[model samples]
Target: MRILLVGAGLSGAVIGRTLAQAGHDCHVIDSRDHAGGNCHTERDAATGVMMHVYGPHIFHTDDAEVWDYVNRFADFLPFQNRVKTTSRGAVYSLPVNLLTINQFFRRTLRPDEARAFLECQADTSIADPQNFEEQALRFVGPDLYEAFFKGYTEKQWGCDPRNLPASILRRLPVRFNYDDNYFFHRFQGMPREGYTAMIRAILDHPGIATDLNTPYDPAMAGQYDHVFWSGPLDGFFGYRLGRLGYRTLDFERFDYDGDYQGCAVMNYGDREVPYTRITEHKHFSPWETHERSVCYREFSRAAGPDDIPYYPIRLVREKALLEDYVRLAQATPGVTFVGRLGTYRYLDMDVTIREALDTGRDFLARAAQGRSPAAFVHAPL
Candidate 1:
C-alpha cells in the first residue's frame, strides 16, 4: 500500500510512521518548511534556547501509552503548567482554584464556601446554556466570569462569548481545592531537546519519505493507495463548502534581562488590553538558565485567508459548514481526515497525538481486513 500524508505535523508523522512500519510506502508532505506543524521547535540561533515556534506546547497527558510513546522519540523533562491571570488591576492564580478564589475575593472561603459562593454568583435562569458567555455565567457567575473568562475568551475567539459555543468552555477546569497545576494529567513535561527533535525522530522510519513545503493535491492524492489528511478539511475539497472559521494568534516578541511576567503564561483579563496573554519562553524550560529572557504578547484574531488557523471556531454557522465538509469527507473515498483541522476542533497536543495514534491503528486494522477506515475517530460536534 502507498500512503500519502497531507501534513507533516504530529498526526501526519505518526500516521506515516505507523503505515511505513507495516511495509507500506509512506510519503509525507507539509506546506511549511518544517515538519512539526505548529508544534515545531528549534534552538534560538544566538541564545541556544529551545524556541517553540508556534507557542509553548507543554506535553501533558495521563495516558501511560501516549507518554511512553512520545518519550521514545525524545527525552522529556517533567514540567507542570502553573498559569496566572491579571484582572481588575490585580494578579491571581488561574484555573479558578481555591487560593485564586480566596485571594481574588479577599476572603478566606473554605472549599465548600468557595464552591457555594461561586454558585451564588451564577445565573440560575439559563438552564441550557448555548454560547460561551451563558455557559460561563451559569458555571462561575458574573464576577468571576467577567474577571477571568470574558475578556480573555473574547480576545482568544475574536468575538463576544455569546457568539461562541458552550463546548469550548468545557475544557476549562474549575476546582474548589488550592491545587493550581494547570493540567490535571499525571504526566506533564516539555521535550528536553525540543518538539522538532522529537518529531524528526518519529519520522525517522526507513519507509517514510518527507517533503516539507509541498502541498498535496488531487493529482498527487491518487499516486498513493490511501491518504491520511491532517490539513484543513475544507482545503481537501478546495473550499466547495466554504472556509471554516478559525482563530489565529499574532505574537509580538520582546527581550528582557530577567523575569517578565514571573510565570510562563499570564492572561490579560481586561477588555482594555489588546493581547490575550503574555508568555515568557524562558520560563517554559526552567532546567536551563539564561540572562536574557524572551517574552511574546499573544494577540488572537479571526484567521484570515493566508494565516495559519489555530482554534476552530465551531460556532453555529461554522458547525453547519463543518457538517457539509464531513459529508464530503465521508463521500470522498480512500481518504481519512484526522487531527484538529481535519476534524475541525480545538485540541490539546496530547489529545491530538492520542487520536492520531488511534487513527493509525484503525487504518492499519482496516487495511489488513480490506476495508475503509472510519471518517473520524470521534464524531464532529
Candidate 2:
C-alpha cells in the first residue's frame, strides 16, 4: 500500500515509520523547508548553540512505552523543567508551591501550614467553578491567583479569565510542598543532539521517503491507498465551513553573551509585561555549555489565516465550528486525521507520539481485515 502521510512532524514520522516497517510504502510531505514541524531545532551559526526554531519543546511523559520509543532514536539527557515566574517585581518559583507561598507572604511556613493557609485563602463559597478565574480563586485563592495566574492568563489567552474554560487552570497545578519541578512526569528529558536530529533518525527508514517544503495537493490524495492528514482539520476542507480559532505565537528573538535568565523558561505574570514567557534555548540543553545564548520572548495572539496555529481556542464558537468539520471528516473516506492539529487539541510530545503509534497499528489491523480505516483514530472533540 502506498500511504500518504501529511506534515513531516512527529505524527507523520512516527506513523510513517510504523507503517513502513509493516511493509507499506510511505511518502511524507510538509509545507515547511525542514522536518519536525514546530519541534524543529537547529544550531545557531554564530554560537553553535542549538536553537528551538519555533519555541522550546521539553519531552516529558509518564508513558514508559512513549519514553522508550523516543530514546530508541536519540540519546535523551535527563532534564527537569524548573519554571520561574516574575510577578510583583520579584522572582518566584512556579506551581505556587510552599517556597513560593512563603516567599510571597514573607514567612517561612512548613508544607502543612502552607496548605492550610492556602485553603483558608481559597474561596470555598464557589462549590463548582465554571471558568478559569473562578477555578483559580477556588483552588489557589485570590492573592495567588492575582499575583501568579490572573495577569498571565489574560496576556496568554488575550481575554478575561472569566471567558476561558476552567480546564485551562488544571494544567497549572498548585503544590503543597517546596518541589518546584513544573511537571511530575515519570520520564523527563531532551534529545541530546536536538529534536530535529532525533526526528531525522526516526525518518531514516528504507520504506519511508520525506519531502520537505512540499505542500499537500488535493490531487495527490487520489493516488494513495490511504491518507493520514496531520494538518489542520479545517484546512483539509479548505475552511469552507469556517476557520477554527487558534492562538499563534510571536517571538521576539534576542541573544546574550553569557547566561541571561539563568533558567530554561521564565514566565512573566504581570499584565504590563507584553510577552508571556522568556525561553533560554541554551538552558534547554544543560549537558552542553556555550558562552553565548539565544532566547525568545513569546507573545500569544489570535492566529490569522496565514499564521502558524499553536494553541487551539476551543471556546463555544470554535467548538461548534469544529463539530461541523468533524462531521465532514467522518463523511469523507480513505483518510485518517491524526495528531494535535488534525485532532484539534494541544498535545504534549509524548501524547502525540503515543497517538501516532496507536493510529498506525490500528490502520494496519483494519487493512488486514479488509475493512476501511477510521476517519479519526481519536475524536477531535
Model 1 spans > 4 angstroms off: none
Best model per TM-score = 2
How many steric overlaps does candidate 1 have? 0
Candidate of highest lDDT: 2
lDDT of each: 0.87, 0.94
Could you give me the TM-score of model 1 versus the true structure?
Answer: 0.96
Residues 87-187, model 2: lDDT tens digits: 98999998778899999999888888888888899999989999999999998898999998999989888999999999999988888888999999999
Q: How far is candidate 2 from the true structure (C-alpha RMSD, Å)?
A: 0.7
lDDT of 1 by residue, 1-381 (tens): 888998999999888887888898999998889989999988776665678879889899888998999999999998999999999889999899899889878899999998899889889999999988899999998888889999888777777788877888888978999899999889999998888889999999999999988877789876888888888889888888699988888999888877777899998999899998999887889999887778889999889889999988777789899888888888888888988889998788888888888888898898789887788866676
